[model samples]
Target: MKKAFLALMAIACCHFLHAQPTRPNQPATDPANTQAPYLKFPTIPPFHLLKLDSATYLTKDDIKKNRKTIIMYFSPDCEHCKHEIESFLSNFNKFKDIEIVMATYQPFSEMKEFNEHYRIFEHPNIKIGRDEKFFLPPYYNIHNLPYLALYDKKGNLITTFEGTQKVDTLMNAFKEKKK
Candidate 1:
């Protein structure tokens, strides 16, 4: 009887050793998992980018010397980008006092159709520029389309909107100047 009990216990131990665990890396004391906080957009450094029409480029100085600037980082092929720009254009009067700089990571030729189709050039307050090789977007740590950044007349960033902002909200943000 003793021999039989020992033999059964040894077999069970062997079977348990060979079996795969359901949760291999987790400890019993802390079974639940936790995640890290989402990374918000970081403060961006001022830089110059090539414009489409003019031989001269745009830089942080342009924003400082002019009225407040609303930096619209968008993609030419993005429908959200189209909608956002269209909405802004439709209510251009609200932001007329503000300078609108439309920038993209795409090449100039690629953006030609969207630029022409939307007649973005028709708006006097608007300035179209190209990032060429995704330089500005990464510099701003922009991860999504239609990222809107509002900067004061001194080229210091006031606030950044991750996605599209309603006209009212956007206008409100523009009204806020650095103190």
Candidate 2:
């Protein structure tokens, strides 16, 4: 009986010793404890989208014509979306060789207002257009806001990033293709 009692005590002590006290230094139990989740744009589908400002529509053929491209979906009323654009605008020169097309599901009036409000005309590489009825989202299987899709010079999908990503990460991703 004494031996069994001592074994129980030892087990209890071990359990107690392993129990961690809640503190700042202690690892968090949240999902954020792991690295942030990243989204890669898919490569299976093709894109055929229309422009909001003009009658011209963008097809896979159109994208195939470019050496490289960046297709992004944004909203005129979205604060996060605007923030993403502002980030791109801040480093517009870095992507001088990359064709960028900004698509919005919102109305043309809103896109126009947003362009005017943000003074997007200053950015030579960004093309603002409407995506309300465009086929880009479905073509690329993108169901999230502020989607940034990168393609190679050969018109192949390189990567598609969802959500707000660090500009440096994106720049590095673009530069990696050169190597």
Candidate that would win on TM-score: 1
The lDDT per prediction is: 0.72, 0.71
lDDT tens digits, residue span 1-179, model 1 = 99999999999999997674547555434323322111233323455667766477766556536577788898888888988988988898887878887888687786777889989878777877776656666556677889887877665567778777789888777675643
Backbone atom clashes (below 3 Å) for every candidate: 0, 2
User: Please, what are the lDDT tens digits per residue for candidate 2 over residues 120-162?
Assistant: 7776666677765656665555667788888777766677887
State every prediction's TM-score relative to the real structure.
Answer: 0.68, 0.65
Model 2 misplaced stretches (Cα beyond 4 Å): 1-54, 58-66
Q: Supply candidate 1's per-residue lDDT for 175.
A: 72
**Each model's RMSD to truth, in Å?**
8.7, 9.8
